[model samples]
Target: FTPLLLENTQAYEAGKTGTEIPNVVHGVGVFSVIGGSGSTLGLIIAVLIFGKVQAERTVIGISIAPGLFEINEPVIFGIPIVMNPVYMLPFIAGPTILAAVSYILMDTGIIERVCLSAPWVTPPILYQFLATGGGIKAAVFTAIEIVGLTILWLPFVMISNKQNVSEE
Candidate 1:
C-alpha cells in the first residue's frame, strides 16, 4: 500500500518536475491482506467514524496510541483501507474529522480526562458502544460513520483513482 500510495506521490511530484515517470505498478499480494488486517482497520474505523471517537493530551492521543506499537499500518492495509471503497472512506475521513473535533473539545475543555486509552481494535459500532460503556447501539453509529467515510472516499478516490488500482 505504501508503495502504491508512493506511486501516486511520486507521480504528483514528477508532474511538478515535468517528467513522465509512469510511477505506479501493480501485482499479486494485492488482496492478500484484505481478509485479515484490512478487516481489522475497517472495524476500528467503523467504530471511530460511526462508533465512539478521540485526541490531545500529548501522551494520551488516540491517534498516537496504536502507533506506539507499530499496529497502525496493519489496520491501514489489513482493513485493505487504501483502495476498498467500502473501508476507504472512514479510514481517511473518520480519523481526520475525529482528530480535529477531539482536539478542539479537549483544548476548549469541552470534554476532559483525555480518553485515557480504549482498545485499539474493535468492530466499528461495537467499539463505539463499548467505548461509551455500552451506552449505545451499533446501528446509529454505523449509519453515520458510513456517510462520513463515503463523503471522504469520494474526493480521495477521485484524486488517487488510478494510483494503486488492482482488478484482482
Candidate 2:
C-alpha cells in the first residue's frame, strides 16, 4: 500500500514536486500510528482520569510505552476490541476522519503535503514535521489529530469502564 500510494501521488502533476504528496503516502505514517499508540494514549489518559475498572491499569501500564512508539497490539488485544461493539466505532472512525481532514488540509494548501518519507515508527508530531519538510503546520496538525483522537476515544473508554464494572 505504501508503494502504491507513493506511486499514485508521484504520478500526479501536483505530486511531482513531492510537496503535494497525497493522503495515501503521507498519511501512511499518520494512519499507522493514529490508531495504535495514538488511541492507546487517549485510552490511558481516559482510564486514569475516569475509569473505575482497576484492572485497566494493567492494560495501560503494558500499553503505554509501545503506544508511544506506534505499537498497539497490547491495547487491542488487552482491551479485546476485536469483537467488542463498544470500541468498533471510534477505533475505525478516528483514523478515517483524521485522514479526511489531512486530505482537505493538503488539498486547500493550508499545510504542505508530505514531501519526505520517514520511518513509520517515528513519533507522531515529529513524523509529521519531517514528512512535511519541517513544516510547522504539519506538526501542529498532527498535534491536533492526537488531541482529537484522544477525545474520540474518551467516551468509548468510559463505556468500557461501565462494561468492566458490570462484568466484575
Candidate 3:
C-alpha cells in the first residue's frame, strides 16, 4: 500500500530539489493496522476497563492476548462486531480518523515515512518505531492514535454495557 501510493509522489520528486517528498501512504499501515483494523487494542482496553457485562468482559478478556498480537478473531467472532450495527460507526470511524491524522503527520514531515515493514503482530508502539526505522516520533504518534481511538470507543462501550445491564 505504501509503495504503491507513494509511487507517483516519489516519481514527481525524483531528482527534484526542495520538493516535499510525498510519503503519506506509508502511514496507512502504521495507523490502520497498528493494533489491527479499527485499532482493536483500544477497543479491547475500553471493554476491559469499562465493560460491566460479565459476558462481554469475559469475551474481551479472552480477546486481549490475541488483540495484542494483532489477531482479533476472538473479539470479532466472540463479541461479534461483524454484522453488529451498534459498533459499526466506531469500527469504521476510528481507523479512518486515525489514518487521516497519520497521513497528515507524515505528509507534513511531522513524522518520518515508514521505511520498513514490521511483522504484522509486532504490537503497537514497538511496531510503529520499527516500521518507521526507529523513529521515536512514530512511537509517539502511535500512542496518540491508540489513545484517541480508545476515547472514541469509550462511550460506545459504556453504552453497550448499560444496555447489557438493562437487558439482564
Candidate 4:
C-alpha cells in the first residue's frame, strides 16, 4: 500500500507539477476533523462493493470535495484501485461486508452518522469523536474497521504472495 501510494498518480502529479505530496493528496487541512485518506480509500473501495451503489457514490463525491476531509479521490483515481488483480477480490468483497455491517449498525441505532462532517483525513479517534458525538464507541468502531480491513485484505495478500511464488 505504501509503495503503491508513493507511485500513485497523485504522487506522480506532484512530482511532475512540482507540488509536494501533502498538497497533491487530499486530507491534511487546517481546522479539520475525521481524516484518514488512506483508510478512507480502503473503506470506500470496500464500501463501493458492499454498500448500496448510492452509498458508494456519496462517498466518492464527498472525497472530491475540496475542503471535506474524505479526500478519497486522489487514492481512488491515483492508485487506480480497480485494475490490480491483487485488489479485485478484497476490494469487491471486503467493503461490501464491512459496509453492510456498518449499515446494519446504523440502521439498528448501534451507531449513528456524524453531525460535524469531519475531514476524511482525520485520525480515527478524532473521526470517532466527531462522528459519534464525542463518544468512545466511534473510536471502538474505527478500530474494528481497521481490523476488519486487515482481515478483508488478507486473502488478496495471500493470493498475491502465492502468485509471486509460482512466478518464481
Which candidate comes out best when scored by lDDT? 3
A best-first ranking of the candidates according to their lDDT comes to 3, 2, 4, 1
Better of 2 and 3 by TM-score: 3
**Order of models, best TM-score first:** 3, 2, 4, 1
lDDT of residue 30 for candidate 4: 14
RMSD of each: 19.0, 3.7, 3.6, 17.1
Clashing pairs in 2: none
lDDT-better candidate, 2 vs 4: 2
Candidate 3: 10-residue stretch with minimal lDDT: 12-21
Q: Ten-residue segment with the worst summed lDDT in candidate 2?
A: 11-20
TM value for model 3: 0.86
**lDDT to native, each model:** 0.36, 0.68, 0.75, 0.45
Distance (Å) between predicted and true CA of 166, model 2? 3.8
Q: Which ten residues in a row have the lowest lDDT in candidate 4?
A: 24-33
- Return whichever of 1 and 4 wins on lDDT: 4
- Candidate 2: residue 89 Cα off by (Å): 0.6
